[model samples]
Target: MKTAYQQFISREAKLADLPALVALEQACFNSDRLSKRSFKNWLQSTQRIFMVLEQGAEIVGYGLVIMRKGTRLARLYSLAISPTMRGLGLGKQLLIELEKQSVAVGKLFLRLEVEKTNQRAIGLYESMGYKVFGDYKNYYENNNDALRMQKAIRHYSNFSRLPTYPWYQQSTDFTCGPAALMMAMNSIAPKVTMDQKTELDLWREATTIFMMAGHGGCHPLGLALAAEKRGFSAKVFINQALPLFTAGVRSEHKKQTLELVEAQFAAQALQKNIQIETAEFELSVLQNALENGGRVVSLISTYRMDGYKVPHWVTITAMDQDCLYFHDPSVPDGHVMGFDCQHIPLAKEDFIKLSSYGKNKLRTALVLYPNFLNTSLD
Candidate 1:
């Protein structure tokens, strides 16, 4: 069966192929070349995919992709083709196979850097649907600039193209409402500074002064007033006419105090032209607000996050067919990663269940509008 025809194959790099890999690296680029030691180490990393393309037992092309820990992103670290194999369409095969491997490993996006002067490589990447996101100055060993590019690996046609929302962690345990509000505001306008001082100021303006624990949580009306005072428009949605956060307070005096505070907030909202709807809006209505470029601050119980079952605040960032993505302001203990707090996804049914709190199932939401518009839900 032996003939003059040759066959090509693609497989993972092996440690024994170090010599050929180093030789290829040396022959490919004059600068920013991966060292022999780098190739050896990368070939052994469980977090990286180092692949080789072989033609008739000869390694003619290779590529490397690195998977970041605790993220849905993969990076194309390096790719090369033998000078003799150039223009043979083998490099495209290597890249496509690498992308397949990355998607197999649960990566949602792939990112890479190409030298600014490498027009051929840039054209290849762009042809493959990669987009240039940004650039770095003097990024290479030879002082050449690099163009940063990224591609969404998944078929996410139904995924919402969300606005850029800044994330903020609450400095205190009771400031989740303020932190969540700050994120929503900055999503509407980026000039709002994201700092601890601003977070505490928002908390001071919105706190209800009574809770089950040390500090009080922010009332929906107070939060709406806080947004209004800061040059933004908002609409408050309350599920019940009862005063919020009053069920947990054991004393009658504290209940009266929360009522008084709620009244003051309502008065201020009316004076400032903020809309307060004393009824729960449907999930579809919330979707309309976000689709119109509005941001929302929602109250949820932490029973699903931790076992505590305490009230918490999270900002609804984006949504798709199967999941709702939000930013939880409470970066709880043992879950310190920013990944744990930013754009956390939950099933739509589970999120709906998490949106209510307390024995009476108190539900509240604040929808923030970027400007004066038809915010009325028709």
Candidate 2:
């Protein structure tokens, strides 16, 4: 019979079955093996249910559950399988059966305890929609902590009705990561209107200093510092990936670049009594920073080859309810550009799609200061 069929039985154990159950329990548990007398008590108790699996009339596995009435909760007491039968999907099947029984008994939730070191068991529970609700420190004989996990059976319709933003816009293939778009929207816009002569002077000065620095594409950091030196709080926003890749290649090269820029601005700000913030992020990073009250400058690139080209930088000047206003460096006349922020709400699905385009090629950065007016350091 063992070779031909397998049987699973959920029934009360008889007095004669104690010796076999005790042997199985000893084989299953290492430190906390159950005694024959304890097995008998559990089997005879009306509040508990003992389930056994048999292959050809030989017991192979067992599980115990403590069913409590009025509270509508079921606690899994123990589950064990023979060493040879491990990873046969039997454990998951037993858990499913127990859940069905609990639901049939009108239980509203199911709970279990697993050791912290037991990653396999923890993963199984988590996959079954069980979430950690509490912990029992040093609960096991080995002093290992136990994680208490629970799964609710009730369906709450109200939870699913909460407001949600759409993932993408249909009219334009131009999409932004939800987090990146949010950061751009949340960032305070640049101020301090410059006359054409002042702007041109600042621009020429920045271009000269940046070109002499031999920093390749990192000229923006120098430009930002030059702007701050002249009594204006300067923010430089660039694509996030450029710095990340640079940092990865040189190991602190990107950090060193920002640190130099910040140090230069800090010295000038101190003399002029101003404050500044310098930061970086990829699309995802920007969203997180924005949600945390960080201000940003946005560098909007020119669309190229079905995507945005690099080297284009912009300073966001102001944000209305849904549109972001910015000064475009690529426009040749330094005109302030306006874009709809609502169309850029960063959603995960949309990010997954857009990020898939260049494989995280888009990047942005931010630099902020308390005051935009002070003195010209450039």
Candidate 3:
């Protein structure tokens, strides 16, 4: 009997291989095997990483990685090895490749949920640097609990020796934008006060027409205006030319209203001498700005951290060559999604990927420079 394929090759999974994938899933998983339709859907999605380990004509193992559009996390959805090939190192090899693919797609961290009783699998994951963050009761269809594990794949050499900043939880779900803006403003200008009243007031001033499901999120221009109105000099950097939050609003009437509000904010920004640049800001530019007593409020997606299809704001406080430190506004009691939602350190590359919103990865930032009107990070 052929224990494993003599030759090993790894490549992306295609639709044609769906049958084999489904078969392998059935063979490996006693429960929770992905259906053929689900395999087909994942095979065609560019946002996910699906790969199969092949031994000439036979598929021996597979790995699946799912990347959230706006967050710094890449989840290892599944990993499997053939029963006949258990002794081989194919599982480890597949895991290493999955991590590589995850980082290449700009993910800073890797996470997975494993059955609590799967000792061998748990040992493998722990050996590969994953630490158990939490657990869920009755997570599996068979009523087995699952352990949540996470590992930071990227290692940065430089470190920023900066003071710890205050953490603020959003009073309401929709106030992440204002809460983050408040954190950034308070970081740069410590004398500025913040409260729930001010948070809602700022939300009223900076909000667009609609959010993922609520009233609206704060626009970059609107956020800049809000900061400027609070006596902080603000500069806006946006990657997309269109008005922000258009992707979240489906109704044409809402879109038009958002456009009008955006236009109004633009005019006000122009009158106030606030700068708006329609280009991606470089990491060096952000570093320079931070060095010059500037704080950055970035629009990010809550999918990775909160598992919600919504945009969020975060205050980028300090950075060095290796890591970018930020005061995250939406801190959950536990890991609601796959991430820690408080003040956190993210790898630079991952931060770049998470700083934008939507599929196009529209990068936007409100850079508030204190006591430096002439400073420019071009």
Best by lDDT: 1
- The top-ranked prediction according to TM-score is 1
Scored by CA lDDT, what does every candidate get? 0.79, 0.48, 0.77
* Candidate 1 residue lDDT tens string, 1-378: 111213768888999989999999888999989888888888888878888888877888789997644345577889999999888777777888888888898776677889999998999999888877566688889989998777767665245343456788788988999999999988777777789998889888998988786788888888888888777788988888857778888888988998898888878888988887877667777777888888889999877555676888889998777557788787565313343456665556667788888888878889998656434221
Clashes of 1: 0
lDDT of 3 at 320: 72
Question: Against the hidden true structure, what lDDT does model 2 obtain?
Answer: 0.48
* Model 1 poorest 10 in a row by lDDT: 332-341
Residue pair clashes in candidate 3: none
lDDT of 2 at 315: 39
Estimate the TM-score of every prediction. 0.60, 0.39, 0.57
List, residue by residue over 1-378, the lDDT tens digit for candidate 2.
Answer: 111123554443456777778888888778656777778888787665567676666677777776542234467777877777778766776677777767776554566788899898888889888877566688788888988776764432111111112111111111121122222322333233333444444344333122112333324444455445434354544443222223222335545655454456445545644333333334544444334444444433344212444333333333322222233322221111111121222123322233321234544445554343433322
Write model 3 residue lDDT over 1-378, tens digit each, in one string. 123334788888878888899999999999988889888878988768888999888888889987655456577888999899897878888888888878887777777889999999999999898878567798889999999787777765334234546556678878888998888877766666678988999999988867656777788888898888777788888887867677767888888888899889889999999998887678788788888877878877666655665677888877777777677776564213423443365777777766756877888888887645533211
- Worst lDDT run of 10 residues, candidate 3, spans 334-343
Cα misplacement distance, residue 185 of candidate 2 (Å): 42
